[model samples]
Target: MNHAVEPIELARDCEAIAIPGGETVTLPKGTAAFLTQSLGGS
Candidate 1:
């Protein structure tokens, strides 16, 4: 059997911004995030 992995695309470019005395999180433009688990059957 063949499995497929889907990725989530970013809508726009994310800029690196400083949080309220917290660490900054940066995600580049057109970032793709894949699903870690399979939802069809567990």
Candidate 2:
């Protein structure tokens, strides 16, 4: 399955975890993130 990779800019500090694998990632405020996929239409 091919998924779209998108570049997302973070507005504030947020915490995220990797799916399929349990990995914690901390995103600081005013940062960017490369999102591969989302859940619940997120």
Candidate 3:
């Protein structure tokens, strides 16, 4: 016997979010500036 499976499709408006360590924060437009000021740029 043979079996077939259908592929799943994702919606266009779908979005993903990561919540690591249970801390939620927002980064402003000046993200590079903030990082440089705090941890220095790479």
CA lDDT of every candidate: 0.60, 0.73, 0.34
Q: What's each prediction's TM-score? A: 0.32, 0.46, 0.23
Candidate 3, backbone clash total: 0
Model 3 deviation from native, Cα RMSD in Å: 18.4
lDDT for residue 18 in candidate 3, whole number 0-100: 32
Q: lDDT tens digits, residues 1-42, model 2? A: 334477678888888886769699888987867756445643
Error of 1 at 12 (Å): 1.8
lDDT of 1 at 22: 63
Q: Residue-wise lDDT of candidate 1 within 1-42, one digit each (tens)?
A: 344377777777665545456667777768985434335763
Candidate 3 minimal-lDDT segment of 10 residues: 29-38
Off by over 4 Å in 1: 1-5, 15-23, 35-42
TM-score of 3: 0.23
